[model samples]
Target: MVTTAAQIGWAESAALIFRPRVGELLTNTVLLVAITVPLCAVIGVGGAWLVERTSLAGAGAWGAVLAMPLAIPAFVNSYAWVSAVPSLAGLGSGVLLATLSYFPLVYLPVRAALARLDPALEQAAASLGRGPVRVFFGTVLPQLRLALLGGALLVGLHLLSEYGAFALIRFDTFTTAIMDQYRSTFNGSAGSMLSGVLMLLCFALLLLESRARGRARYARIGSGTAAPPRRIRLRGWQLPAQVGLLALGIAALGVPAVVIGGWLAYGGGTVWMAPDLVPTLLQTLGLALGGGLVTVIAAFPLSWLAVRHPGPFSRLLERTNYITSSMPGIVLALALVTVSLFFVPALYQTTALLLLAYALLFLPRALVPLQAGIAQAPQSLEEAAQALGRRPLRAFFGVTLRLVAPATAAALAMVFLAVAGELTATLLLSPIGVQTLATRFWSLSSEIDFAGAAPYATLLILLSAPMTYLLFRQSTVLSRADASAGPAPATSAPTTAETA
Candidate 1:
């Protein structure tokens, strides 16, 4: 942060603040966020309600379908849309693409909150002559305040950092502007100035979200083991409800599938069998696995300290880690470059350095689940194992580790998928000759070789499919745990880190 701040002089900052170009970028960014965030919230909250609270058929299947969009990177979705409809390449298209791709961030957490809500409150409201809508607004929405705000914060932060989708749509924001500035004029002050403004925007978002989240507790008290929520019978609206869900599924997941399928069918004879395809796929997988393992291992100690030994110092350490996660990938990559150049020249541009960058950027994804899991695991269980003559480490493995295994696995998969889909950081940090799927696709697409890029995009989606499924499945487990144990403390959801 100090380095970034130092890069901007008062004159440069003033110029950025007054420049028409900067104003245009700011307007475009605010417009995108204003349009996208609410759409995500409505779709996410409504979808969660329909799937989790209503007597909708195939609720489980619908849940999976709704959450599947997280597997499709926003850039891939933008490519799909732009390839099919060249005219759809601007602010409107950017907003639509991002909303479709990122609503799942809101959906997952809101759905989990809905799953864990004590249905008794809603039931009470309904018995007092309230309609369903009234009951929801009056009784249920208040409980969702924290989840909704947190999800919206994630979406907002992502918009601030997003580059790929916006860039493909020909829409420019601070992120894209920063990338362009850097590309055209290496380490330019204009880029740093834009980054300073972006950082301020992020800090404002963090402050607003924290204030909105408030200190109110959503946990249920005096619970006699709340019964499963009674699903609201849709009755006359059942068929329409099903159709709506089906449409959402198709809209979010279908467009990309069809676009990629068309590309494969048209170009497969030559490009499908390319030799580099296999190597790139393997390289992406290796990086993702290595990065995921290293990140999780690095996060364990911090998460443990936060959970088991809560204090101001531990909390500060955790918060300090997240500050980097909120920064754009390019900014973080540049910071790494600067530090490595001066102090660790041998590590510069090495795979180890690249993996370290991934670990730094994605540690929160690993830490959130780990902290939650550790918090939920009973101290008594570990004590019991220790009483049985086991060592501390052995007791942890036998008891706490077993208990948190689902969340641990979820963290690993989340980080793995994140690393696989990452773009900007990988672009800057990868070794001289290394080409991951994301970079390869970006390269081909930039050359307007949509057909050639199709295969990499397809494989990226295929690789993400299983991890996405694992996320949804583990979400179910977490939801169940939350429901039975009462509302867990709020933690930050994952944020996207990119720049156009």
Candidate 2:
């Protein structure tokens, strides 16, 4: 970053400062986040409440359905929308697309938090003559503040770094601008300047989130059998509530499913068996599997240390890793390009370099789950194994690993789905002539060949579905575990892979 900053000439820097296009990009970026994040929070929190706390029919199923959007990459959602409505290709579309795609980030965490919340305070508030709305605002909402803020932070950071979705929608943000700079001119100084600005935006977001999160502890003390919160009967609103949720699910998940399904059906003759399709799918799978495994292995020690040996240093290491992962993929790809070309030319344009980018960018996806898993494993169990004449490694394998296996698998799946769907880094760092599903889809779609892109897009969604299901299931398990054990501390935000 320092080197890139130093490379920027005063005139070029001044041009960026005064450029109308740059201003538009900044405004679009800000407006997208400002509009989208809050809307996502509202939808997510509201949906979660209805599912988890209301006596709505099929709440469990609705919960899972709400999370399915996470499986559909934002760019694919844009493709689905734009294919249906040609004019949906600007800031408004971008906001709508992103909100639909990312609201699940807020929903999952808040749902988990809601599951673990003690109902005593809420019950007491109701007893004092407070209505449902007042009780929620006065009691439930304050407790939810941390989860909501963390989720919103994730949404904001993602909006700042988003490229593919916004790019497809023709809404320029820092990420897309930097991508254009690299593509059109390989203008390192200008791209780096934009990236530097993005970094500042990310930092400001982190700072704001931290301040908003504060230091308050949300865990319940002196827990007995904490009763489940009383479910408020939807009564007259039940049918409308179900309809609302169904509509949300349709907009978020059904559209992508139907669009991809239509494409496969209509384009089956020519596009389904396109010679490159299998190769691209295989390549994408290979990279995603390799990247997922490597990232989880890399995350294990960091996760282990943070959970088993909590301290300033361990916390710092974990935080540092997250901050690195939060960087825009374009910025990370450019940094890797420069380093590889300068210090290790042999590595440039290699699969190794591309995998490294994935590992760096998606590490947190693995780390979050692994750390939670490790934290849940009892130290006494490891000690018992050790006392039974097992080595530390053996004890961990026998006890800790078994305990965390589900979480580990979930983490692996999350990272795999993320890598399979990733675009900007794959564009920059994948070996020359290599084609993954994402790059191929992007290539075809960029030329307005929705038919050609459809097969790859369908395959991407198909690939993501199981993994996304696993992630949602794992989240539910984690929530249940937290509820059983006692109140959990404010949930840490899960770092997303595509965020810059």
Candidate 3:
């Protein structure tokens, strides 16, 4: 069902978070990115090198540690810092908080890229008399360029839609300003105007990422040819590496860890075991799982139609999917709200509505990965399976589906993370008093009761740990067995990263 926003253009009204009067909001946003993006890129590269390429002790443990901050949501980190100092919501502190919250975007990709690189190149570079630092700068950095930009793109897109943290700290950005304008002034036009500008900014960042990442292949595909990437000698830098690693980890993870720990120590120990918490957990997880399954299922038809039909309408639909995905969660949720209440009243405030919102907000993520996976699976294999006494569905399942499952799983993980971290949609469209971990955390933190919110924050992080793992664990082996045994000879096309 197309929403009211689609019909009447509510987005323009909500988008005015970028209105000229709110020039400070635009300035704050640019300043936040200018500081945070570079900081994260540096941290990501340095942390990846320290954990994956250095002779640092317990690199495996360190690798997990570096990625663990991803489990900590930006809002939780912001909450902890503000709670600890009560004055860190200042502009500088917000930038620091945002940087720590997002560095994992760079770290996971760089780490995975480093893990997949052939050690021989660096070894050869060394043999040619280039020092390790020079070899890394020349060889490693180029290969990492796509993964790094990809990660930065994720953070940039996320920041464009960020609200809870910024809202909590009394900072205003396009996302927060739009919501405030809507709730307080009920000025849909102003909100839409701001949203329009934010949309432009999102596309701008995406375009930047696309250009930066053009046509770069990061992974070597063959199984037997793959070698563990070389480790550099961090002989004297061990102490520096350790100190830097500890400092970053402590600031990022330690604040949240200590806050949650103190909550558990105090009267809030039972908050972890609250009566409603389990049900809320089940509700949240159920929504994520069902949303993932349905989004992937839905994406196939959309992807297949484009892949097979190859027309202007198909291309338009494909791009429209991305447009929906790129919209801020709140904007999407409000769109759904207005549409459903007026048109599909039966669906209002229900699980189906919530899942539909998730699909609309995140469908493009599932679509792109599935499209790449399906493209790699090839049309020929499905045809061959059909020639061998199978139906179209069977051929797709046995041949195409099997080949595409890895990328599908990856797509699922990414959407799962997006849904789990989502705040604005849950805030608006969730049934009366529906207490998601995110909602509960926001509710408590809004009351200035950090202790009450800590458990939910911790639980939310734990719930998302698997996703954090998958972000870097893409280095794990592809599902090679299915492709190996297909009824037809499975011809492989290039992977997404391969075609870049």
Residue 86, candidate 3: Cα error in Å is 1.6
Q: Which 10 consecutive positions of candidate 2 have the poorest summed lDDT? A: 491-500
Q: Estimate each model's TM-score.
A: 0.89, 0.92, 0.82
Clashing pairs in 2: 327-500, 328-500, 329-500
Our tally of clashes for model 2 stands at 3
| lDDT of model 1 at position 474 | 73
Q: Give one digit per residue, the lDDT tens place, for model 2 in 1-500.
A: 56755567677676765688778878888888889999999999998899888999999889899999987888899989888777887788888999999999899878878887888888999999999999989999888877788889888888887788888877789899999999999877787778878888888888787777776666665663457789998899999998999899889988877877787677768887788988888899999999999999999998999889899998888888889877789889988987897789999999999999999999988987898799899999999999999999999898989999988997898899899999999999999889899999999988988888998887888888887787688778977887777764444433332111
User: Using TM-score as the measure, which candidate wins?
Assistant: 2
Off by over 4 Å in 2: 9-11, 373-408, 488-500
Q: Write the per-residue lDDT of candidate 3 for residues 436-455, one digit (tens) a residue.
A: 77987898899987777877
Lowest lDDT 10-residue stretch of candidate 1: 491-500
On residues 1-500, what C-alpha lDDT tens digit does candidate 1 reach at each position? Answer: 45544556566567766799988998998899889999999999998999889999999889899999988988999899888888887788888999999999888878988888888888889999999999889999998887788888889888888888888878999989888877777664566678777888888878777777776766655553557888889999999988888887777889899988998888958987888888998899999999999999999899889999999998888888887788778777766776787679998889999999999989999998898888999999999889999999999988988998987887888899899999988987799889999999998988889999999998889888997887788778878886787654554532222100
lDDT of 1 at 96: 90
lDDT score for candidate 2 against the true structure: 0.85
Candidate 1 at residue 348, lDDT?
86
Determine the backbone clash count of candidate 3. Answer: 18
Q: Which candidate tops lDDT?
A: 2
